[model samples]
Target: MPVIAVLALDGVPGHELTGPGMCFGTAARHHPHVAYELRYCTAPGFRGTGSPAPFRIDTPWGLEGLADADTVLLPGHAGFRDEPEPEVADALRAAADRGSRIGAFGTGTFTLAATGLLDRCRAATGRQYAAELARRHPRVEVDPEGAVVDADPFHSAAGVLGGLDLCLHLITLDHGVPVAIETERQVFMQLHAPAGAEDATGPAIRHGTGPHSLGPTIRWMEAHLDHPLTLNDIADHAGLTVRGLNRRFRAETGLSPLQYLLRARVQAAQRLLERGDEPVERIATRTGLGTPANLRHHFQHHTGTGPRIYRTAFRSMVAALTWADGKHAEPAEPDGPAGADTDPGPSGSADDRRAARRRT
Candidate 1:
């Protein structure tokens, strides 16, 4: 289990503290086998600077909690303009020296910058505070647009909600895309969707055949994954020239048409591998990859693992989550080999898993 230590300071934003807690807590609920231990710590005599609300929060640990942390998060506080205590700075430095990942959000970037770890690194905070952040820390590159900047062990996000985005990114790093998506869906369900609508598993993408909307074209591409689709064919279907399609795709999806197609195929293959006992060659054929060798190359590129290994890891994780849910009398293990008699009992449909994976 990875340990996340949240450095709670005086006046820390309640949302900042709760955001990460909620994210990591959701991951634990869905994937207990790889859960993270969340620890909140404070310096001696510390009292949070209550803003949006007036309140006081007491923590269970001290600066020492950061010593063995896998990741340390610093949430925004009211006194961010002021320098952190010598002990706080020293503790952050020590954690970084030991290879712990450090993250900050909103004006908390100022506190992390004060520790000198962000020197010569790109960082972000609320857009309004970007100029002041750069002015105060000449050595640090501050992005005014407030995009999330990940400088290896040090990461920072732009605003309060950006803090949640940062936490979700960390979840993706620690537990893979599927787990992160599930956690994100859970969070959104609590925030936006009404009760009894939580089990919805439709593709988040909207579909339309009009020139202005690629949703329908993307959906078409997904449905025709087994066909050998050329850029020209896709462009023709979208009523755009090759160059126009490329531009529009990059603008809307951040991926070129062919890149999107390849990812779709890979995703299709992953779903099949997870849900059924199909041979690699058949899966490759069904997903339009042409050959098992081709599938191996692209699957490894996208997932950082071969199909067999990915299937094993994925199924084991699913089984663990299922067993933890008390859905079975005995904890189930993944079926042995491709042709074995195995039961993938009660795992949600491939569409559900795909929806969860693509939520982020």
Candidate 2:
């Protein structure tokens, strides 16, 4: 049985803390042998605060939980004014060093990123916080997409229920896609969430000239992953000759334009697979990978799995997608220090607070 240690920090969001509890609990109950034992740990002091401790947490599970766990889950809170207390950050770093798969529910991703494990890794976080997560951790590839973001050892989500996606994905990774799909059928009463990139950071491309020459163009390619876009069209928009675009794009983003486009298409195709919608052929066309044969060509070439099975195993949200609203979503500093409270936290009983978000 894999023991999942969920860290309870001061001011941790109740929903963020509880979402994993419910889904993983369901997994354990249904799966049995591969069941997960969920542990909750608190920080040093809690009960002394006047009005709900800001996080609605009166008691935390303490330091010991980090030592014995298969997976470590970090739930983000609004108070991200700085990196966690030294001991807390150390424990998080230690967990990362131990080969334990590290997870962050929301802004909690920032915590894990601070541990240096996220450098150059792709990931996701709460919609309200996508910008900051990217800016604060420049080395980490923070997906502006929605719902869920994942890069192996590290996984994150956009809003409340994203925790469900994370747990379901873990099941797939641990057991098999078939088992995960079955579990989703049992819990979601729907097919598994789409695979590929999430839209959490959907369209949330970082603006400005620094990478505008490069980042903006790549961002555009990512968005059109589902639409039909030609290299010439992309070059025109980027204001470069096809050859120039190819050269500059590769030098700047480390990928040729077509290569990057293909990657985005594959990622989108994965998400489509997870959504369980549209026939594979249409999904391929929609994502610009084109035809079952073409999709198979790229998907098999890149991921080693055909589209259907890949969706069953690894799909989450639209990969690298920032929601449409995120484009104009309220602007924030894009970086909050430890203990800084930027957004509103959850409230009510633990269960209600956890369920408050339907699919944020």
Candidate 3:
């Protein structure tokens, strides 16, 4: 059996934190050879404990509990911005360094990235934080697409409840499509099952076959976009004998790794500009794109509009999406029932699509 140690940090989104435990718990019962043994480590002062009694209780595990696990799962939480008192990062990084497969859900992706374990690795997080994560870290590659990403042993899901997608894929990959179909039929929720799986809930993935198949060096390059990285640096990090990572990167993101990084920088600059908190040069440096002139060039090329205008326009849209006469932001859709791509995250539909079109 493959053992999984879940670092049940506090403030993990209620469902995201517990969902993996439940999914893997079910797997343990449903399959003998590929069961997951889960243990939750208790940290006395973590954000996830604020939930009501049932959610914020004691666990049987401790930091040392992660030692023997084959995979370590980190659930997302908003509280990760603040450093933890315990040697939390050490435990997570240690497990990751040992080649244990790693998984993250919701904001948990942020924590994983923070350990620098995910440096030069392609990672994904909730849709809300994709731009922010990229800007702040400047190194990690975050896919905004809803599909789960598996690079080597690291599997990540985007957005809330995205873990369901990641978890289902894991079962299908290990147990075969028929077993996945059996499980899906028994379960009552809609899942984004990639193609080739007999019981997939969505379109199949036509590339890479699986996550672990991605190039190891490419993974490292995506993880370290923050530092002054060159193609040589990336190749060296991935332990690839050649000095060029461009071809593989082009294959992965439809652009060379540097091109992808620049594009990502532009996007990050745009997001921060919208927040109305920084100047263009600062935003450029922060995004790793460099210069007001350079930002203007790409910003104009990408959106057919200049940076100043984009930021002004985005700020206006933000105001309209949240406040009507200066009110607090409300749910994008409060009355909508559970469904596919329900909440696209704090934004306006008509304006957003229009803006997104402009970017494309």
Candidate 4:
């Protein structure tokens, strides 16, 4: 199992300290195969204080714990504006030298910057402190607007949600998109306390300008992913000519309109695969891929696996996870059972079910 060492400092944000665990723990719980050992460490003789809630903490590990960690995470603390302890800086430097991925959350960027590891690397801190970070560390390029900055081997995030994004991203790097997507859904469920509801992120483009400029258009695309939406249709919805739409869409999101739509469709298919034993043909139609072959081609291209294998793998993983947790794996439900096949297939007719059954 990979080891992730989180450095707990005085006044560390409670949310940041636990955010990575929520993501990694959920991945482990759901998939079991993508397990990680999360370790919490602190500086020598450290008696840390939790943020917002005045409480004391005692960490189990010291700076030595970072020596062999696969990744090191630094959560923002009360004294982030001040220089990090000399021993802490040295430990971080040694970890970097040994090729450990180091990340800072929120104002923790200041601590990382002080160590000189982020010099000449792009980093992100809280927007309110962006100017101060740039002024203090002239060599570091500070992105005030970005939620997270990925400077290989070294990363930084803006705030709590940014920290969550970074944690999911690291999981994605370690495992794959499938595991990451499921973990994201699990985190969303915990945040919203809702059952079987879609997360707000919704498999859309993550890196983009604010929704103020393209909210309606993006929401429309998300709502109509099951439709055979063309460029003209999207442009019409946006009330822009093709050329203008292309320009503006590219600006709002890094992808072109069709590219974004296709990604959304593929992601939607992934969720279906992870959540249930839906047939590939039905999933393809529901996700607007139109045909199983098309779904397979694009799904493989984007996720590096076929839909059938993806579903089978998820089921097997969940079963293995259940067994590992000292629980018996639930028996599989009978195929096409009443209420199980209630979801209408592509054609909204009984023939659609027959066709899906045949294809499956």
Superposed by TM-score, candidate 3 places the C-alpha of residue 326 at a distance from the truth, in angstroms, of 24
State candidate 4's TM-score: 0.56
Name model 3 segments beyond 4 Å from true: 47-54, 84-86, 189-360
- Report lDDT (Cα) of residue 178, candidate 4: 65
Determine which window of 10 residues in candidate 3 has minimal summed lDDT: 200-209
- The most accurate candidate by TM-score is 4
Q: List the residue pairs that clash in candidate 4.
A: none
Candidate 1 lDDT, tens digit per residue, 1-360?
788999888877676777888778867764434568899898765776455554677667999999999999998776788899899999999999999999998778999999899999999876556666777899999876556677888988754442666787777777677666666555643443346554222222223335577877887898899999999999999899999999988877668899888877887787777767899999999999999999999999876679998777666655454333223111112432343222223323333434432442
Reference-based TM-score of each model: 0.55, 0.51, 0.50, 0.56
Q: Is candidate 2 or candidate 4 better by lDDT?
A: 4
lDDT of 3 by residue, 1-360 (tens): 677777777665556556666566555443333456667775556544433222555676877888888877777554765554448888877787788888886667777787777788787765545655676666888776534677767877653342545665666666764444434322321232234443211211111324433345443443454457776676666454343455555565466666665655665565566544688888777766667898899888765678888767655644453223112211222333344233344433223322322232
Model 1: weakest 10-residue lDDT segment is 324-333
Evaluate all candidate structures by whole-model CA lDDT and list the values in order: 0.73, 0.62, 0.58, 0.71
lDDT string, candidate 4, 1-360, tens digits: 789999988777666677888878878865534668999898865565554544566666888889899999997777887889999999999999999999887778899999999998998875545666777899999875435577889977655442666686677678876667667666654564347644423433443334446667876897788898988898888888888888887876768888888887987897887666679999999999999999999999876679888767655554443233222111112342333222111121212212322221
- Candidate 2 or 3, higher lDDT? 2
With candidate 4 superimposed using the best TM-score fit, by how many Å does residue 323's alpha carbon deviate from the native?
Answer: 39
Q: Provide backbone clash counts, one per model.
A: 5, 49, 20, 0
Ranking by lDDT: 1, 4, 2, 3
User: Which pairs clash in model 1?
Assistant: 10-48, 10-49, 11-48, 11-49, 208-216
